[model samples]
Target: MRILVVGAGEVGSSIASSLSDAHEVVVVDVDPERVESLTYSEDVLAVTGDGTDLDVLREAEVEKADVVIASTDDDETNLATCATVDTVSEAFTIARVEDTNYLDTWREHHGAFGVDFMVCTDLLAAEAIVRVVGLPTARDVDPFAGGSIQMAEFEVPEDSPLAGETVAEADRFDELTFVAVIPEGADHASVPRGDTVIEGNARVVVVGRPVSVREFARALDPESAASEVEDVVIVGGSTTGKLTAEKLVERGVSVRIVEFDEDRARELAELLPSVTVYSHDATDPEFLSREHIKDADVVIATVGSDERSLLAALLAKREGAERTIAVVEQARYVDLFETVGVDVAVNPRRVTAEEITRFTRERRAENVAIIEPGGAEVVEVEVDEDSVLAGRTIQDVMADLPAGVVVGAITRDGQYVTPRGSTVVEAGDHVVAFVQADALEEVTSKL
Candidate 1:
């Protein structure tokens, strides 16, 4: 497949880097330095030109592209690029925008601005934060199989019942699969074997039905298993924070938003009548104490600056907040946020990249999640009659699959199956599998 990406910024570069591994990728940008840097670092063709111009699109051979991704920082530029590409070819056009207004308009009117798909960073980040709020102990949570199946990552606490148990011994949930485990202080994660002992503080990834996952989470930490989120405090009035507050309010959860900027705070207060908006700096300990941050069931920091968000989250934790979630823009700071006590870290750039990469995957895959950033992925694919995966038992399939890959779960005719060796995959079944980054291509080909 041939893909043309417009923009060489963080999101664009990330999409190109990931797509280049499995497909022919061409990246366009006005900045020669960024284009040159990508050219030197990735296996993609870097074109230094204005992506919105027809001549530039022709130069990149957009007519031959299977997909054209417009990801410029400017929403107008991205829309224009997609429009131009649509005029010249029948390629699928994906446009990235930070403004919810543009996204809402595009979504209501399909093909508006010549965009087949629209990815909103703010909405994606907000949704990620909301998922964390729903499952407080999960470092990350993603839904697949049309919400019937879920993939979640949790840190094994020192006192967890399964802390010292091996994978085979800790298999208590009939509907859940323990896919992989990342040992404490380890740089890499692996598929857990029967004898693999889960150590304290290790990250455990599991996939199963939503109800089963909730039960498994409760078993992992009985004290923090209340899945109902009552109080949520957002420490920023940015678009991400506002969106999150809106979602929580719709779900009937009590929400309070704290903003440093008086004007923005006033706007949010007027827009969100159900939410409590405070015009105060979250970085100040006095303001936080006055707001009773310690009573918040979940505290989310989505400030513009990563440092500010991190600091606010730390303060929330210090104030005895049950869970803390921070929006960190820099990918490198994600681990640091967790290390410093943040329960979850949401990166908009990475979220956008993951969405775009899912669109680039084969049609059989209904959903794709970048579980461990660039290291691991979990894909939900439909077993087609023509595919090699159909009409085979899980044991038979595993024998031919590459290492570091596991069939996590399957859904057939609306019924969830925690795959076992004897479980046979039928055509039209949705199969979710965990694949290591290096084995993704091989596994996808077989599926």
Candidate 2:
């Protein structure tokens, strides 16, 4: 597929980078210098031009493109670009509109503007990061189809009911389905362990609809209260942190932020009137103690420095906070926090970059993620009527696929089915697979 990405800024560049592996990506920006410094390499075609201009869109061959994404910084310009694309081509157009005002009424406005989808960076980024502050016990959450289904990762606590239960026995919820198990001290990373007994605090992964999943998690340990966290404290004043705090407030949840920078702290105070802001060093144990971090339901550290963030979370956790989460950029320290009892270590750049990725690679990347440990991955693809595996079975598809990659299960209309040897895949079904990173392109052709 050919895609035109407007604005070679951080988000636009990230979006372009994610699609360059599989699609023909064209990047257009107003500033030639910005476009030049931005690297997409020869994998992507870069051009210097105003994204809102008709001539520029025409020159990029917008009509022939499969998707046109307007992700310029200016919201009005993005809307205009989307309108232009809609007028000229039948391609799917996604506008990167950041203003909350437009996003509030997007579902209704999108159809009138011929916008196939609207990328609300703030909304997505907040939903992705907010829970880290509210519920740090969860390692990761994959929300599907506007949150109709949620796949959440939780580690079994030492005193939980799941402590001594086997994988099959531990997952007893009728609604909650056990997806996969990444066992402790396993050399192979993750395994489809069925009869393996779960140790206390074992990383148990599950998938289910929203309310059912929460109930299932609550049943695992009633005292932990891991599933119900209403109070949250954020320790950062960055754009990512502030946006996360704001979204939580909109959901009628109480949130407090401790920012060290006076100027940024004041900005957050004025912008988010509902949230209480404290202008003190979040890393300082003295200030944290004064605020009584022990009573707070959750403590999230996003102080820009991985060391500082991790230290704050550790201090807060020691202070008796229920859960502690940190935003760390360093790859080495990702699992370090969880290992040392600090709940979550999120890579903000990776999270923010993937937001733009969804804009460019919509058809593909039905469930795309940049996995950890050697940058390997598992991607879920949909088998539409036009797909190669439309009328084929799992066995037939496996014969054509390389040995490194393999399909796992079938999701027909949001319902997951364990694929047996004779399981056949019909049209309009989504295929979840565990794939080797380098062979991603090969998986696309077969799907």
Candidate 3:
């Protein structure tokens, strides 16, 4: 796909970096310094010019672009750029909206202007808080098909009855998808085949019926009753950390935030009097010990710096914090946290990009989320008649499935059906399959 991305701000840079792998990206921005500083292994053509000018877009061949994304910090600039692109091409246009309250009006009013999608980071961050507050036990959650299905992250505790159980051996959840298993020492995640035993210490990632995800989580740890989370300790007090604290407080979760920003600390102490706010560096073992970090059930790091966030998680883990969720913004630092045993990396920019791509993809129906290490996710999509596997059963079609891919569940209408040798996938049926980045093209080839 040819993508014309306007703006070189944080969101735009993240978008260009993420999409450069799979698309022909041409980035335009007024700042020559930012454009010149961008380094990408893949082809990313950067042009220094005002994005609102149609002539500049024409020079970049915006008409040939499959999609145009306007991500300038200024909302009016983005809107104007989107309007100009609409005049040049029928390509899909996405605008980074400023006032989140104007989303409905802009979405409705901009059809003639060719703005197809409105992305607001505030709303994206807020939705992240929503997921955490809604499911406090979940470390990470990916919404799909407009929240109809979710790929949720969790760990298989040592006490879990599923310690040695395999996906094929045990009766799988009816509405749930068994996604990927993140083993202890590998750069990649593996597909969970039935009979693939669940290791006691493995960081298992699952996709299933929302009820099944919860039930499976509870079934793994019988001691964790439905609403049994006692307390949570959050490391760092950045904007994301503050928002997380507010969300957790609203859910009645006893929250403690360890931050280095004294002013922000005082602000939080005043706003959330119930929360214990401490002004201290989380990487400091002494401060962690004084705060009783070892007693918390979950520890999350949302500090701005990746190095500090990883260090904080490591210190918390050494202090006996059970679950350490780390905030990771830079793509290069994913490995750093992985080595440091960080539970999850909340890259909202990547999440937001995937959300925007959902609107541009013409063939995909009701996509929910994208899984990491490239291409692994559980997608519940209707099989239109034009699809390749409309009349095929799972056994006949999935023979060439790659190592990191597997089918988990199939649904016809609202009823969940167990896949088998005789089960035929007809048009209008939805399939939930787990695929790795390497297997994605194959998964789509079979449609």
Tens digits of per-residue lDDT for model 3, 1-447:
899889887678766765565578899999988888764443699888889998788877998998899988788898899888888798888987746555768657767445887886545654664475455446567665345556777667667788788876544576676668876554567877677788776667776567776777777776653565557887877667776777777877889998788998898889778889999888888888877899887788878788888888889989998667777777667656765587656665666666665554435546645655543555556788877658887777666455665665666767666666567888988776676766565565556
Best by TM-score: 1
Q: What is the C-alpha lDDT of each candidate?
A: 0.90, 0.71, 0.72
Q: Once model 2 is optimally superposed onto the true structure by TM-score, how far is the C-alpha of residue 52 displaced, in angstroms? A: 4.5
> Please, what is the TM-score per model?
0.97, 0.68, 0.76
- Model 2 misses residue 244 by how many Å? 4.0
Q: Give the poorly placed runs of model 3, Cα more than 4 Å off.
A: 7-55, 71-90, 96-115, 122-139, 145-148, 153-165, 170-172, 182-184, 195-203, 218-227, 258-292, 318-320, 389-392, 399-405, 411-415, 438-442
Superposed model 1: Cα runs more than 4 Å off: none
Candidate 1 local lDDT, 205-249, one digit each (tens): 999988888898898898888557899999999999999999898
Residue 237 CA displacement from its true place in model 2, Å: 6.3
Q: Give the local distance difference test score of model 1.
A: 0.90
Top candidate (lDDT): 1
Q: How many clashing residue pairs appear in each of the predictions shown?
A: 0, 1, 16
The true-versus-predicted C-alpha distance at residue 33 of model 3, in Å, is 11
Give the per-residue lDDT of model 2 (tens digit) for 310-380. Answer: 88888898888887777776646777877887777776545655655544544555765444432334456
* Backbone collision tally, model 3: 16
